[model samples]
Target: MKLETIDQVAVIGSGTMGSQIAMVCAIAGYRVVLNDIEESSLEKAKESLEGHMERWIKKERLTEQQVAEAFGRIVYSTFLNDLKDSDLVIEAVVEKLDVKRDIFEKLDQLLPEHAILATNSSTIVSSKIADATFRPVKVCNIHFFNPALVMELVEVVQGPHTSDETAQTAFQFVESIGKLPVLLKKEISGFVANRILGKLMDEALFLYENGYASHEEIDLVVTKALKHPIGPFALMDLTGLDVNYYVRQQRYEESGNEADRPAKTVEEKVNKGELGRKTGKGFYSYT
Candidate 1:
C-alpha cells in the first residue's frame, strides 16, 4: 500500500512505546487509536502522554496547541475490534513470542485485508510472528527506540515474508512522523542498533560481574572515552533491566547459546522487581 493510504494508525498495548507511537502518529495528523486490554493502563497512558508532551513543549519541540490537536486525534480503547478500520496496526506488546503471535493472529482476522501489521519489538523479529497471520507480506518490524517521542532512529525490518511495498510504506510512515528510518534488508534477532548495543552491554556486564570495574566507573569511561551519550548499564536501567533480561533470554532460547543468557546482575534485579525508573530502582535507585 502507498504511504498516503495509511490515514489511520492503531497502536496495540498502551505501554511506554505504544502510547508515544500513537502520539507521534497523531502529531503527524493521522487518526490514532491507542488500544490496551485494561482501562487503567489507558488512563495512565493518557496522563503520561500529556506529561511527555509538556516536556516537548518545554524543549520547544511542540506547542500547547499542537499537543492539544494531537490529543484530539487519538482514541483510547480496550477493544481490539476498534482497530478494524485502521490502515496500519503497530503491536508494542511484551517480548514474548507466543503473546505476539496470538495478537497477530487476532489482528489478522480483525483488521481489513489491506491493513499493515507492524511490531515495535527490539529483539523479536517479525518473521517469528508473521507466520501466524495469513497476510505475512503485510507484517514487518517497526522498532522504535526507548522514549520513542525523543529518540530519532527507528528500524524498519523487512522479513523474508514481508513485501517490498509493506517495508517501503513502513519506512515512509516513520519518516512522515518526523523520525529517521533505516530499512533492514534481512531479519536479525536484534536488528541493527540493538545488536551493537547488545555487544556493548555484554562487555559492560562482563566487566562489572568480574569485578574489573564498578558499573559507575565503566559508565564514566564509556561517557568520557567512548563518547557515548549514556553508559550501557545506565541505558539498561533507562530501558528497564527486565526488558534487557527478557531480550537476552529470548536470544538464548532461540540460539541455545548460554552466552546469550541474561547477565547475573540483571537477572537478580528482575527477580527483585527492580526493573528501572518505573520501579524506582534498577542499576541505580530513583526517587
Candidate 2:
C-alpha cells in the first residue's frame, strides 16, 4: 500500500512502548487500535496514556483539546480481529523472536494483504520475524526508542525482503508522525543506535559487576564526563532491565558467546520482577 493509503493504524501489546506508539499515531491524526489479550491491560494502558497527555498539557507541548482529540482517535481492544481494518500494524510485544513471529503470523492472517507489518523491537531485526508472514516485502523494522512519544529518532530497517515502496512508506509514515527517520539500507541485529549504546551498556555493566565502581559512580562519570543526558545504567533502568536481559539473551542464543549473555545482576532482577521504572526497581530503585 502507498503512504497515502495508510489511514488506520494498529498496535499490538498494550505495554509501555505499545501504548506510546499508539498515542503517537493518534496524535498524528490516524485512527489507532491498541490491542492486547487482556482487557485489564488495555484499561491500564489508557489510564497511563491519559496521564502522559496530561503531563504534556502541563508542559505546554500539547493543549488539552489536542490531547482529548488524540485520545479519542485511539480505540483500546482485546481482540486481534479488531485490527482487520488497520493499514499498518506495529508489534510492540515482548522482545522474543517466537512471540514476535507468532504475532506477525496472526497479523498476517487478520490484517488486509496490503497492510504493512512493523516491529518496535530495539534488538531483533525484522527479517527474523518477516518470514512468519506471507508478505515479507511489507515487513520492516520500525524501531522506536523507549518513551516513543518523547524520542525523535526512529530507525527504519529495510531488510532484504523489504520492497522499496514498503521502506519508503515506513520512512514517510515516521516523518508524518513528527519523528525523524533514519533509513538503514541493510538489516543488522541492533540496527545503528542500539549497537553503539549496547557496547557502552556492556562496559558499564562490566565495571559495576567487577567492582571497578558502583553503578552510581559510573553513572555520575558518564553524565558529568561524557556529558550524556542520562547514564547507561539509568537509561537501562528507564528502558527496563528485563528488556536488556532479553536482548542479551537473544544475542547469546544467536552467537553462542558467553560475553553476549545477560549480566548476572540483570538476570537476577528480571527473575525477581524488578524491571526498572515499571516495577519500581532495577539497577536502581524508583521506590
Question: Which regions of candidate 2 are displaced past 4 Å?
Answer: none
RMSD of each: 1.0, 0.9
Task: Tell me the tens digit of each residue's lDDT in model 2 across 1-287.
Answer: 78899999999989999999999999999999999999999998999998998899999999999998998899989889999999999999888999999999988998889999999897888889989999999999999888899999999999999999999999999999999999998899998899999899999999999999999999999999999999999998898898999999999999999999999989998999989998898878886
**Residue 91, model 2, lDDT:** 92
Worst 10 residues of 1 by lDDT: 233-242
Per-candidate clashes come to: 0, 0
Give the alpha-carbon lDDT of every model: 0.93, 0.93
Candidate 2 collision pairs: none
Q: Report the error of model 2 at residue 163, Å.
A: 0.3
Candidate 2, residue 287: the lDDT equals 69
Please give the distance, in angstroms, between residue 3's alpha carbon in candidate 1 and its true position after superposition: 1.0
lDDT of 1 by residue, 1-287 (tens): 99989999999999888899999999999999999999999999999998888888999998899999999999999999999999999999878899999999999999999999999998999989998999999999999998898899999999999999999999999999999999998999888888888899999999999999999999999999999999888898888888898899999999998999998999999999999887899888899
> TM-scores, in order shown?
0.98, 0.98
TM-score of 2: 0.98
Give the per-residue Cα lDDT of candidate 1 at 188: 90
